[model samples]
Target: MGKLGDMANKAKEMAKGHPEQADKGVEGAERMVDERTGDKYDAQTDKAADAARRSYGSNSTTDR
Candidate 1:
């Protein structure tokens, strides 16, 4: 596999072991993007974070 694929697989494996932290990481990224865009991309950031949480098999938290 290529480097990107390898990295993705590694992330998936890590998330499986630490789903909560994985979800937090996604939430942090979403917040960073939203803040950087001055809330202009809040909707898209939320959608992406939700998708990432599902992919990581993690429960969503009330952090918004």
Candidate 2:
């Protein structure tokens, strides 16, 4: 597999039983993006974060 595919495989393995961490990571990314854009796209970022959490099998909700 290519490097991108390998990295995706590793992330899937890591998120297997650690979805909360994955959700946290997604939330952090969302927050960074929000800050960078001055919170102008809060809804869009939140939706994107939720989508990412779903992809990682994360049921944990972000408090941010």
- Candidate number with greatest TM-score: 1
Write candidate 1's Cα lDDT for 31-62 as tens digits.
88988999998888888888888887877754
TM-score of each: 0.88, 0.78
How high a TM-score does candidate 2 get? 0.78
The true-structure Cα RMSD of candidate 1 reads 1.4
Candidate 1 segments whose C-alpha is farther than 4 A from its true place: 61-63
lDDT by residue for model 2 (1-64), tens? 9999999989878986698777778878999999999999999999988887777687777775
Q: For model 2, which pairs clash? A: none
Q: Please list the C-alpha lDDT of all candidates, in the order they appear.
A: 0.84, 0.84
Off by over 4 Å in 2: none
